[model samples]
Target chain A: MKTYKCYCIDLDGTVYRGKEPINETVQFVHHLQQQGKEPFFVTNNASQTPDQVLSKLSGFGIEAKRSHIMTSAMAAAKYIAYHYPGKDVSMIGERGLHDALLENGVNIVSSSKEVFVMGIDREITYEKLAQACLDIRQGATFISTNSDRAFPNERGLMPGNGAFTALIQNSTGIEPIFIGKPQGHMLEMIRLEHQYEKEDMVMIGDNYDTDIMAGINFGIDTIHVNTGVTSTEEALLKSVRPTGTFETLVECI
Target chain B: MKTYKCYCIDLDGTVYRGKEPINETVQFVHHLQQQGKEPFFVTNNASQTPDQVLSKLSGFGIEAKRSHIMTSAMAAAKYIAYHYPGKDVSMIGERGLHDALLENGVNIVSSSKEVFVMGIDREITYEKLAQACLDIRQGATFISTNSDRAFPNERGLMPGNGAFTALIQNSTGIEPIFIGKPQGHMLEMIRLEHQYEKEDMVMIGDNYDTDIMAGINFGIDTIHVNTGVTSTEEALLKSVRPTGTFETLVECI
Candidate 1:
């Protein structure tokens, strides 16, 4: 197996299944750390801040630096700061998105915005969604963190930010700029920030559509594990197959 | 101009614009009443009950019988009762929907639903939406009141039931059975209840997509007035033109 300088790993399904940690993936991360390599925790989860991700990683017995975490919220903030600089942003998200936007020096506004950013907000309201539609209809640049339709929690699969974005898009007839996995913006951010070549970076995850597609879209190698949303059989059926497939990260290591 | 026994009039833009009444439409209704004809008020609005609609009409000096009001909520409840008899229904809507469901003798359940009905809910929550998605995924028949994406209000165009329905549909990949305008369910219900023939009924409204289309779909004559969302010019451009076009309902009278 070939080794890479930067291993961009997905969180929810790859590292852990909700609250339960994947021991094989944990040990793999430990092996990488022992070799003096820090893997980037790339997640389309824009609901949590880097510190929050760090805390979760620490709970799983893997010590990860806050900078090693690249959430879609962070990528969205950076994307806005880089592309729509000096533009006032109206956002519909939680603390993670807010914190990232502020940290990236993106000006946030309540209304009269030139740019609109959306993320997974558990406390989403009709008023907020309505405002986003109004802004987009009024010609604001729309951007969303991810296009995940649903995500699993204790209750089951719930509506993700993508569904909300779809609602706004359907209402306003505007397609948003998605800055999460499957689009490669998050991976691009990691590559640009760390100054790594495409060949030096690899994406590892348990999902094919988001994680593996992100790597492929970024023109890098991808390893798909069978512990998440997509089964190995389904992944193999895709025309654009992953660079490699494994039962678990233990097999990769 | 040909007169009909049933005048299926649209609300909002046809009868009143938000809290303010359209004077020409108000006088037109009075003319119909003077001729001993009580027009049926048909609206895609599932938020208000028939009594609430009656109050609004009375406020405009038009005393309307409660039976003469047919909201999308009423049609949705009736449709559910007729099609899925004895099925336990779960719904996400306002007081109007709740009232109509109970009035129609449809069994309403909090969970373990056989059918799920969606309406425009101002106090929408993630949990409610999540449950709706889960129910649909669990094989519950999904039904929505209307497909009006946005409606004009005091604040501006607010997200309608269609937008919320689109969110759930996107999350679940299940298209809902819409019981509102352009489907003709509401008009069909009015016809069935009043036993009026198709030629004896006419849909009168200002919107081309909802009012005129509903009449066209129900195989009845339609009068498009230049008072609301779609102007007469826009309505004329449609291949399926209304039976008659008027500057106001006064012209029809």
Candidate 2:
């Protein structure tokens, strides 16, 4: 098997399932580290900062560097700073997104009709949502971190950022520029920042739609693991198959 | 011009414009009352109770009976109680919806998989929305008070119940049965409850889509007034024209 220099990995199912780590993937990551290769952790989660992700990974017995974590929030902030330079941004999101924009030196304004970034805000209110619509109606460009409709919790499937995005889109009749998986902005960020060629990079994940499709969209090799959202059977049904399939990361290692 | 026995009038754009009364509509309502006829005030507003709506009309110098005011929340509660008798319902809404369901004798449960009613919840939270999605995923039937994506407020157009409904619907992959305008449930409720025949009724409003379309869908005569959302010129352009078009209800009077 050919070895890739940069391994972009999905976190939720590939590294850990909520609080529990996937042993096979964790072992594979340790093996990669032993070989002096630091794999990048790519996640669509916009609520947690890289530091927070690093802490979570640490709890799961995985030693990951802060620079190796690429969240959708970071990508969104980078995209805004790159595309609309010096434009003040109004946002509706939580700490992770706030931190990302602040770190990226994007001017954060309370009210602006120029650029608006949306993320999952637990303390979401009708007033906040109204302000977003008001801004969008006033011709503000809309951007969202991820498009995961519903996320799993201790109780059950909960409303994700995508559901809120749908609300705003339905209200304003404007589709937002989604900066998450299946769009490949995150992968592009990793590639450009690290200067890794497409041939030397690979995306390894458990979900076919967001993870594998994201790799395919980025024109990179992808390995689908039957550990999370999309099982091997479901992944095979898709027309755009992954570069490889594994029962777990143990086979890849 | 023909006078109808049941004059169904829209509230926001027709009778009043955001706390200010449309003089022509108020005068027309007074004229109807002088002839011992109480015009029915129909609104897609699911946030206010019948008494609340009556008070608003009274503030406009028009005395309205509580029973004469038809709100979407009332219709939704009645619909749920009639269709799924004795079934417990989980809901995401405000005082108007709560009072209506209680008045209609529908059991409101916190975690029920029987029926789910959605309305404009100004104090909306992520947890509440998540719970609603969970209940719906557990096989609960979905119902929404109205499908108004956005409504005019002091700040401008604000996200309405329909927008929130869109959020839940997107998350759950379940379409809700909307009870408000353009669906004709509110009109049907007024007709069935008051025993008004099709010819005896004439729906009057300022908006062509919700108000005029409600009357059209309800199989009744409709008067399009240029006092609010849709202009007379815009109304004429629609493929399904209203029964009559006027600058104000003064023409009908």
Candidate 3:
């Protein structure tokens, strides 16, 4: 098997499922760290800050570097900063997205018709949604973090950011630019920051749609593990197959 | 012009546009009432009660009978009462829907796996939406009051009940049964309640998609007025034309 310089791994369903970590993936990460290689943790969860994510990973017995964390919120903020700098942005999101925008030096306004970004707002309201529609109607550049329709919770699968995005899109007849997996924005951010060639980096994840597709879209090798959304058999059935598919990351070791 | 026994008039675009009443439409209603025909006011607005709609009409100097008002909320409540009797309904909506459900003797529960109904909720919260998704995922029959993507307010067009319905539908992958204009539920309820023949009824409105489509779907006569969403030229271009296309209700009067 070919060794990659940069291993971009997914968090949920790859490293850990809810609070429980996949032991094989954790062992695989440990092995990579022992070899002096720091793998990047890529996630579509834009609700939690890098520190929160690091803490969650620590609880799973996997010590992940803070700088190596690449959340969709961080990517969305960086994307706005690089693309539409100095523009006041109206947003409907939580702390992670707010902190990321501030960290990226993006101006956060109460309401803006210039640029609008959305993340998973657990504290969402109709007024916020109405304001978003008004802004979009006034020709705001609509942007969303990810497009996961339903995310699993303690109770069951709950509505995700994509569902809210769909609402806005349906109302305004305007599509938004999603800066998450399967779009290559996050991967591109990691590549641009670390100056790693596409060939030298590989995406390892359990989901075929977001994780593997993100790698494929970014022109990198993708390894699919059957610990999450998509099974190895399902991954193999896709027309554009991942570089490798395994029962678990244990096979990779 | 062939006179209809039952003239089902739309509210927002036909009778009035926002707070201002269309003088011609108001005069047309007077003409109908003078001829001893009590025209029914059909509205897809699920937020306002019948009394509120009546008060609005009364303010415009059009003496509307309380019994002659048919709202989407009332129709939804009636539909639930008739079809899913004794089943608990989980809902995400406002006071109008709440009152209607109670009036129709339909039990509204906080959480239900049997049925779920949604309307335009201005006080929308993420938990409400999340709960709706969970209920739907748990095999609840999803229902919505209307399918208006956006509605005009002081601040341009705001997201409507349809937009919220789209969110839940996207999240749970369950299509909701929309009981509003363009669906014929309101028209059907009027027919059932008044015992009016389809030929004796005429749906008059400015919108071709909702009002005219509802009439056509219900197998009744429809009049297209060039006063709202659909223009006379646009209405003429549709494959299925209305029974009567006029500049305004004054033409029929």
- Top candidate, metric DockQ: 3
TM-score of 1: 0.97
C-alpha TM-scores of all predictions: 0.97, 0.98, 0.99
DockQ of 3: 0.91
Q: Give each prediction's root-mean-square deviation over alpha carbons.
A: 1.4, 1.1, 0.9
Clashing pairs in 1: none
Q: Tens-digit lDDT track for model 1 on A52-155?
A: 99999999999998888999999999999999899999999999999999999999998755999999998988888888888888888999999999999887
DockQ of every candidate structure: 0.73, 0.87, 0.91
Model 3 alpha-carbon drift over 4 Å, by segment: none
For this target, which candidate reaches the highest TM-score against the unseen true structure?
A: 3
Give candidate 2 regions above 4 Å deviation. none
Report the lDDT tens digits of candidate 3 across residue range A80-128.
9999999999999999999999999999998998999999999998899
Model 3 chain A is weakest, by summed lDDT over 10 consecutive residues, at A244-253
Candidate 1 residues B1-253, lDDT tens each? 9878999999988988888899999898889999999899999999899999999889988899899999999999999999999999999999999999999999999864589999999899888999999888899999999998888776667788898999999998999999999899999999899999998999988889888999999899999999888988899999989989999887766
| Candidate 3 interface RMSD after superposing interface residues | 0.5
Best by lDDT: 3
**Better structure of 2 and 3 per lDDT:** 3
C-alpha displacement of B242 in model 3, angstroms?
1.5
True contacts kept of 1: 0.62
